[model samples]
Target: MNRTIAIGDIHGGLKALIQLLKRIDLSPNDKLIFLGDYVDGWSDSANTITYLIELAKQNTCVFIRGNHDDLTEAWLRTGDLNEQWLQHGGQSSIDAYRNFTSEEIKEHLAFFKQMVNYYVDKENRLFVHAGFTNIRGVENEYHDTAFYWDRTLWEMALSLDDKIPTDHKFYPKRLLLFREIFIGHTPVTRIGEDKPVNMANVWNTDTGAAFKGKISAIEIKTKEIWQSDPVHELYPDEDGRN
Candidate 1:
C-alpha cells in the first residue's frame, strides 16, 4: 500500500518531529504531508523550516501554509507587522531569524510564498492547514484569513450533524460532495483522534507541541498516528499537576 503521512503542526518542535519520524520508520517510498505551522513556539523555527525545505526538495513532501506561517511570511516580506504575532508565539519566530542575513530572510520569504494552500487526492482526501468554509468554491478562492486563521470554519467542518452544510450556497444535488478533510490548527488532546462530531470528516493533528502535549503525525492510508513526547522541561504548574 502507498503510505502518505500527514504531519500535524510542528510549532518549532524539530526534536519532537525528528523523534516521531524515526518511530514511524519513514522511507523514500512514503510521502510526507506537512499541515503547516512549521515554525514558532519552540527554539528551532529556523532549523525546522530549513530542514522541511530541504525535505521538500529531495523527498516526497507536501508543505501547506498555516496561519502562523502566513504571519511569519508577512513579517519577512514587509519587515513590519502587528504586535499580535508576539502574543501568539511570534517572539520565538523573530528570534529564529536573528542569525540570518537580509538576503537569507528574503530567500526564506520567497520559499514561504511558494507553498501550496492545500493538497487533494483522487480519493477525495483533502489536506489543508485549516478547514475551509465552503468546499464548492474554486480551490484557494477563500481569503488568507479563512485559509489560516478561521476557527469558525474548523468548527463547522468538524460538526457531526449533517444539518451544517459544507457550502453556504446550494449546488446540484448530484454535485453534493463530501471529501474527507485532514487538517491541523486546533490542538486536540491527541493526534488521529476523530473529533466529537462525526459528520465533519476532519482530522486534527496538532497535539499541542507548544503547550503540554506531544508532536504528532498520521498515515493517510492506514490512519496510523505517531507522536513524540515533550523533549524539554515543562513549565511549573501552580495546580501541582506536574
Candidate 2:
C-alpha cells in the first residue's frame, strides 16, 4: 500500500538518511515528507542536499524549512556567519561546502530557498519544521519565521492536562484547528525519548539526529516507525553537535 511518511531532522547525517530510506524500502507511490534542518551537524550537509534534490526526481517528497535551514541560508547568501550558529552546528555545514563550486553552492541555495514553511494536506494534517504561535492557524500567522522557530505550540501541547475534552472552551484552539500536526524542530531526545513523541495532536518527529539520537520516520497512517542506528554511531570519527 502507498504510504505517507514523516521524517525527522537530518542534520546532515547522510548515512542515517540512507539507512532509514533503505529500511523503509521506499516505493514510487510512497510520499516522503521531510521535516528540515537538512544541514548543520554532520559533515555531509552539501552532499545531503544534493541527494535530496536527486531523490525528489524519483519519488514524492515535501520539504519543510527549519530554523537551522534559515540560518544556513542566510550565511550562504551573505557570507556572514552567526557566532551561535557556528558553535551549534553551522561550522560543519560550512566545511561541507568548502569543496563545492560556486555553481554548486547556488544550487544548494536554491534548494533551501524553495523549501516551504509548512504544509497542510487534504487530511487536515499539518506538517511543519516547528510549531506556529497563531491561534488562528498558519495562514494568519503574524510572523513567517515562527513556522520554523516557534516552540511554544509543542510546549503547550506537552503541558496540556490530557483530561480536557476537545470541545471544552479551555482546550487550545490551535490544537483543534488540525487533525494532527507533525513537527521536527524540538528533538524528542531532549525530553528523554529517542522516538517520536505525540502530545495531544502534535507529533514531534525530531529524534535528535543532530546530537546523540538516531534519525526516525513515522508512517502517518500506521504510526509504524523506522529508525537508523544512532547518528553518532554512524559517524564514529566525528562528534555531531555534541
Candidate 3:
C-alpha cells in the first residue's frame, strides 16, 4: 500500500517538523497530510508556513485548517481581534509575520484559505484537524469553529461508552460515520494510548507540541508512529496573558 503520513499539530515548530520529515525518509510515492495548527505556539510560524507552501508546490501535501490558522486569518483581515489567539500561541505567529510587508501577508492569507477542512481516503481512515460532530444528516458538519477550536467534542468522544450522542436535535442518528476518525486536538500525554469506545477509531496524535510536549506523526495504513522531543517550554505565567 502507498504510504500516507499524517502529522499532528506543528505549532510553529519548524525545526522539529523538518527533523521529523528527515527521520521519516519520505519517498516520491508517499503522501504527507498535515493535521493543522501549522502556526502559532513556537517562534517560527512564518518560516513554517513558508516551508509548507514550498513543500506543497513540490509534493503531494494536504493541508487542513486548524483553529489557530482560522484566527490568524481573521487577524490578518481585520487587524482587530480577541485575546484568545495570543493566549494560545498566536503571539509567535504575530512575531513571525512582523517583518513581512502587506503584500506578503496577503499572499500568506491566500495560502491559508486554500486549506481543506478534512482529508478522507477510500479506506476507513479520516484525517481532520479536530474531531467531527454528527450534526443532523451530515457525518462531519465541518463547522469552522468546531473544526479548529472546539475541545468539548473531543472530551465527549473520549468519554463516550460506545456510541457518540447526536442529541443536539441536529442529528437523529446515535452514531455517525462508521469509519475511524483521526484527529489532532486535545493533546494526550502519551501517543496512541487514547482509544475510541465504539469502534476502531483513534485520536492517536497531538502530544502538545505547544505545551512542552512531543510532536507526533503517524502512518495511516501501517499505524507507525514517530515523535520529536519537546523543543520549548510554556511557563505558567505565560498562560492567558499572551
Candidate 4:
C-alpha cells in the first residue's frame, strides 16, 4: 500500500529534510503532502527547493503555500521586498539564491505560483501550511493570509478539552468538520518539544527546523512520525532565522 505522509514547514533545512525522509524511508509510491515555508530561515533554501522539485517528479506530491513562500514568490516576480518579509528570515532565502540566473528565478517563481493554499484529500483530511477559519468553505476564504498566518484555530483546539465536550462545547469546533487537520506554520518547539504535537484533532508537524529544532513528517493513517537531527547541528556555522 502507498504511504500517506504529511511534512511540516521545511524553512530551508535541507539536511533535516533529507534525514527526515530517510528516517521515514519515503518511496516513490508515497503520497507526499508538504506543508510550506520551503524557503527562508536557514541557508540552502535553493537546494531545498531544487530537491523538492526533483522529488515531485518521483512521487505524488502536494505543495501548500505558506506566508514565507508567498513573500519569496512576490520578491522573485517583482524584486519587491517588504519590511516584514525581510525581517522574518527572508534575507536567508535571498542569499541562498545569490547565484541564480533570471531564468532560474522565473522557474522557481512558477513553482511557487503552482502551490495551493490548502488541500483536502478524498478522506476529508485538510492539509494546510497554517490555519483555516472556515473548514467547510476553506477553498473560498476571503482572507488568504489565514491559510498561511492564522493561529487561532490551533489555539482553539489547544484550549478545548481532549474528549468531545459533551457539556458546553466551544462555539465553533473547526476540527469536527474533517477527519483530521494537519498544519505546519506554528512550530511545536515553542511548546518545549522538537516533535509533532497533537491537540484535539489537529496535528502540528512543524518542529522549528529553521531554528533550534528539527524537521518532521507524519504518516496520516498510522500516526507514525519521523524527525531529523537538530537543525543547528545540520548547519552549525550558519545562524538560522537570524
Estimate, for each residue in 9-36, the C-alpha lDDT of model 2 and write its tens digit. 9999999999999999999899999998
Worst 10 residues of 4 by lDDT: 164-173
Clashing residue pairs in candidate 1 are none
lDDT of 1: 0.71
Using lDDT as the measure, name the better of candidate 2 and candidate 4. 2
Instruction: Please identify model 2 stretches exceeding 4 Å from their true place.
Output: none
Give Cα distance to truth, residue 43, candidate 4, Å. Answer: 1.2
Instruction: Identify the candidate with maximal TM-score.
Output: 2
**Per-residue CA lDDT of candidate 4, range 135-240, in tens?**
5668667799999999988888778766656334554546777778999988887879788999877899989877888888999999998889988898989989
Model 3 agreement with the true structure over 1-242: per-residue lDDT tens digits: 56888888888888778777877886767789898988888777888888988888767988988888888888888887669777777777888899988887888888898998777778756677875665541244755566666665556566555543445444323235535667786677533443212222556478777766667888876778877756464323332112
Candidate 2 weakest lDDT stretch, 10 residues: 183-192
Per-candidate Cα lDDT values, in order, are: 0.71, 0.94, 0.71, 0.87
lDDT tens per residue, model 1, 3-91: 89888888877878888889988787888988889877877777788777777775688888998898888887787866888787788
Give model 2's TM-score versus the native structure.
0.99
lDDT of 3 at 147: 65
Candidates ranked by lDDT? 2, 4, 1, 3
